[model samples]
Target: MTYRVFSRATVLGTAALLMLGHLPQAHADNAEDLITRGRYIADASDCSACHTVKGGRPFAGGMAFKLPTGSIYSSNITPDPAHGIGGWSEAEFSRAVREGTRQNGASLYPAMPFPSYARMSDSDIHALYAYFMKGVQPVAEAPPASDIPWPLSMRWPMSLWRAAFAPSVPSAQKDVTRPFPDPAIARGAYLVEGPGHCGACHSPRGVALQEKALSGSGGPLFLSGGAPIDGFVPTSLRQDQRTGLASWSEDDIVAFLSTGRNRKGEAFGGMTDAISHGTQHLSQEDLHAMARYLLSLDPGHPTATAWHYDPAAAAALQRGDTTAQGAKLYVDHCAACHRTDGRGYAPAFPPLAGNPVVMSDKPDSLVHVVQSGAALPGMAKAPSAFVMPAYGRMLSTQQIADVVTFIRGAWGNNASPVDAATVAGLEKSAPRPVLQDKPAPLN
Candidate 1:
């Protein structure tokens, strides 16, 4: 064999050519990976909860949000060039997501929760863009224009609101992947503060309708509980024993997020949508991390005592005592499902005793659930869809009020009693449920 003396330059040149030959495949693989990551981010963000309606094409966007001023519909986020975001460049998409700016430099309404999304890392945003632009199927349908009246309907004020209330736009190249000392906590924080946007519904809003706190840095007000939205009030996510998750273990939190129910309670209202479209699909690791971070939070009200189960109400009911204001009504209607002890069948009918949502100082959710009832969304782990029948048609307003008051005060529950006036107000404002030809399956 003849030994060939090759120059180092020649060897390096050949190596470069070989590397270049594989570059296309590498690029393609990277793009696919980014798109995959983006899909996960979208799910974590619960984008579909706002963008898609029941039985509608995913991300086609026709869901209407009824605001105090008027109703505003979500815009199509699919890749259709004409009616969706297909025409948007990555920069345009970034601006819209991070800065609340639209394709035409107009500002997006806060209904999009850009204030929370503004904290998302650039890498995450890039991945989200990749998925929306490449992975998602395009839809040509455009949602109807917002019914918000003029002045409020105008987009200009949105820019001002964003500037004043929203977090500053994150640096384009910055990756805020680790803001906490613990890796798991950091991951959870990112998910909650950025894409998860839990504060949008859970945190109270100021006079300007901006969330009081964006993160834990905003103090106890963060995730402390919010005003009613669509009849149901978002319960506190903090550590308060009475009205928050102080009773929930990390495992319980994980179970609730993944399956929409746990030993403590079952999801209803917007939370059902969140579980069905968003959290149920998340990896166990992510769910655990979220649970861990949530558990780490300090109680919103440090002085609040842990809830203890008292059987006084149960004892009274067992003795056939109908003297209590709403005792007869509860025994007549709710006892079969929720039981006399106020402890319902586990993972089926949620236990009312020591339940955080029930004990919440704000009785909006309790009243709403009593009036409108709620449907549990089915998921992979839990497929049986359970619905609490609406009593609006069956029970008079006073009867409903009395029953709610009894539940709230029963079983050692520390919640304030709701009166007929409060119940009447919620009933009047509550959305009229669409009458179905066939009754929903209770199981």
Candidate 2:
């Protein structure tokens, strides 16, 4: 504990930190093994779900993501020395994944979702590097051009956006000493928060498109579900009994993640893709781990339950004032298919009664569905899944909100009604997907 000894310890600590930053780019005991590990990590992170060629090899990179600012496609991240990251050094690859920096010194668009990937540990990062470099086929495909409008499409602005919104590094590990707490559960938490980047899609976004809160810190509002994408409602991960997964058990969660089905509901929305390509492939241990971690979240999280439906809602619906405009539309348009009871036919038409999405606090999914029906994501069980037909073209924002509100309140539900203003905002911002028809399923 002497001064000279203290100085030596401090010097050693600083040197260790410096060495990590200055380490050689992408060193691996076995480059091929490293690449294979990285491929698994990437899948755990669901990278291909967002970044990959439509019909080509898995990581060839051409998936297009639509945002309020513009449409951005996944970049060509293959190890092509000419068109891809063939020349990126180890530090550069880490920077792109961790810091959102491109090899050219430009910041990548937040569309890459590095904000969530930033939570990955150093060892995992190295493993990811190995996978991308060795395991992946070096695709020479050119990246599809983005259609971001003018100033919005500009990539430079994301530099400031990174500083303001992105987390600079990964999150610190939570307590790990607890025994019998399910190693897979901890791994699930790590994968979900860090590599999985589930929050990127499930968490609500701010004006800058940043995740509302990384770890459900603000409230259940964190992943209480987000705006609908490609026509499927984003299921709320909240612990609410009626509107959330109150009825689900630990095993139920596991079954849903692994098989994409549970007594609660079938995975039809974006979840179908998440399950079929993502979690279903994950080891049972990891799935159980994730379910445990999710269940371990602090229930009765600190947030006002402003969305609970009241008697006023019931009175309004009875008087034809509850989501008034929506009521007429439902009776006129939706009721025939969805039924006046709000319960659509069995498996063919998903029932709104006791459905978490229909009973959620947020109206994102409800509104989007009313405005833009579901899109064709390649699947076989139900060929040409019933498209909801875009009501956006025919109904005003208020009407859409009202109908959503009516459906939400129907059938012993307790969710609040949607306002026209909320509907109007999404209609102006959220883009409708243009899937012409279902693509052939992957072999």
Candidate 3:
């Protein structure tokens, strides 16, 4: 099979270049200034999403990544100087940030999303390095090791992967950058494409987990939404009325991205994670820009065909003998607020009739949701919803699968049926829910 380069491939190689001997000579710039800039860059770039462990020290790496090759764990990026990147030269830090290479010779797993960071300007990388070394508090927690099996974990292969796919350039405007009515929107585009790397999740991945487009290249819909992430279908940010954000205003966009809450509804599923760890820390300008750029998309639906669920199968959900088993489960468990119609409270429960999470082919998401009951903010807010309790403790794997499948396929919905076995697996895979610092508004 032919393999192609992903946005990240280029990112890793380019980040590598940043490390090529450009050590931070004792510059006259004040340490505080460097730390401040680094903190901004880190926040803007969402470094913690990959580098930090949940419930652990800030910036201490231990996030587990499921790579095509094998599972990889993020290393601690702290300034411990021994276990972390502390003793590395400035160029080394830059390369790791911009490229995928580490201090001496180890190759970083592509899960690091360096391809996107590779485009970041050198100054930004320098600032980030300085912050880690001099500004921010480093934790003593050692990073958890990866679990890539046998030959696949053989680090040397990653070099070939880098050579075949990684880019060596930095983020700069091309000969042509698109016009934006709002400068904030323009800035958002830059952040999304360069540091934010939203496309890594919002955009579709090709054969080898490469982001289909970098900077959402083909159209405004680039990172707009309606793509499968993990197993859930993320809503598009574009201005399309139904599947896209057409109904949302600029302010709504800003609010949603920043606080994970808005008039349209609270952020849900994976989005909750993104906001809690990534977007929440972004500057008001960057958040506004991201919202602006996303809203500006021309109603591009990445998975139009995929988003369309199987109608015939869904019809069976409405009429089959099994329907009763599912319906009772839903009502007894779900109906109080979502309503029997499956049209959840607007912007709150998210009408299941068309909720992307319910319509996804990969039932892992729907199943996970039913069994685990969405961790704290994973249910979106501003409405402060989630009356649903943890079914993991209450319901059997089979019961969870039946109800979730019913939710996904009933009403006007049309999604693949979720098997009980799938639900069982999800029960084993997902992480335990945690309390958010502050809960989002429930509708």
Candidate 4:
């Protein structure tokens, strides 16, 4: 055997060459991992909800959002150079996403929810950019221009709106830090206030259309409740027993987020789209984190007591005594699906007895559901698309109001009674609920 001694310089050079040889493969693997992470981030951010039209290509845009100004269509976000962000530099993408400015320096309307997205970390933004640029299929489609009228449609005003209302990204990041001792809560806060942008629909807005509060520390207004969106009021996510998630356990919240239903209620309206495209795809760990953070909130109405189920209405109905004006309507129409006990089949027909939605301060959602009817959107965990059929065409406004009043008042529910006037008002405003492949915007 012949042994050859290698000099130190030769050994070092050979080792360097071996490492350099693997760099391309290593870089490729890293890029793939980043793209995968970006996909998850996009799902969490619910990028598809507003961007994709029903039965249309994902992120191809053309979803119409009816605003007070006029109807504005979502822009195509695919990688097509002509119509999408394919030509955008990472800095341009970051500016648009965080500061609500387009690549051309035109301001994006608040409907895009960039204020909430401003809280996203740099890493998450980077990953999202990588995924949109590398993983998403290019689509050569252009959406219609906004009919928002000239002065309102002018992008300059949006710059003023951002200056007056939008929080700085750094300040928003600081607000999500260590409010609670648990790191999980911190993570949850980041997800909710950042990528999730739950407040865009769930939190009340100011006269300027800015959300009243951005994070938990901002006040109880954050996720407390929101104005009617597409005829359904976004109920409070706070711990209010009557109208929020006070009674929901962490697991119950997780179940609702992942499966789109729990013992409490089923997802309807914009919530359906939110779950099918967003929360259902989240990891269990993240789901639990969100649940824990949500549950940590104090009751919006601190003096409110937990809702209890009363058998009085059920017993009265069983005895065939429909003394109340609305009682007869409830028995005739609602009793079949929502049983006499007011508890519908689990995960199918959601229980009305002591349901938060039924007892919400504003009965908009319940009234709208009764009038236009709602469909419980399907997902991987709950594949059944259960629908509450529209009664608007069949029932008079008064009759619809009466039945809604009955549902809200019966079974120990103490919400304010609905009136024919309220129902009449909604008749002119509320959109008929439709169960499409992709749900319309929640707000």
Local distance difference test scores for all models:
0.86, 0.68, 0.66, 0.88
Stretch of 10 with least lDDT, candidate 3: 378-387
When 1 and 2 are scored with lDDT, the better candidate is 1
List runs of model 1 lying over 4 Å from the truth.
1-23, 171-181, 434-443
Best by TM-score: 4
Q: Which run of 10 residues does model 4 get worst, by summed lDDT?
A: 434-443
| TM-score (C-alpha, index-matched) for candidate 2 | 0.71
Give the per-residue lDDT of model 3 (tens digit) for 250-359: 77777777666654455656677677667777767777777777766776744454333334533443454344547778777777667666656755555566554455
lDDT of 2 by residue, 3-115 (tens): 54458889999999888765554344466567777777876877776666556776777887766666777887878898788899988999899789999889998777787
Give the TM-score of each candidate.
0.93, 0.71, 0.75, 0.96
Where is the poorest 10-residue window by lDDT in model 1? 434-443
On residues 1-443, what C-alpha lDDT tens digit does candidate 4 reach at each position? 99999999999999999999999999999999999999999999999999988889889999999997799999999999999999999999998999999999999998999999999999999999999999999999999988988887788988999998899888887876745869888888889889999999999998998999988988899999999999888988999887899888999999999978998789888998898889999999999999988988887679888888899999999999999769998888888888999998877778999888899888888888888877665678777667677788789999998888888889899778889999999878777655444433332
1 or 2, greater by TM-score: 1
Candidate 1 per-residue C-alpha lDDT over 28-109 given as tens digits, one digit per residue, 9 for 90 to 100:
9999999999999999999999999877898999999888789889999999999999999999998899888999999888
Q: Which candidate would rank higher by TM-score, 3 or 4?
A: 4
**2 versus 4: better lDDT goes to:** 4
> Which of the two candidates, 3 or 4, achieves a greater lDDT against the reference?
4
Flag regions of model 2 displaced more than 4 Å: 1-34, 67-69, 147-157, 170-182, 216-221, 227-235, 300-349, 370-372, 375-406, 416-443
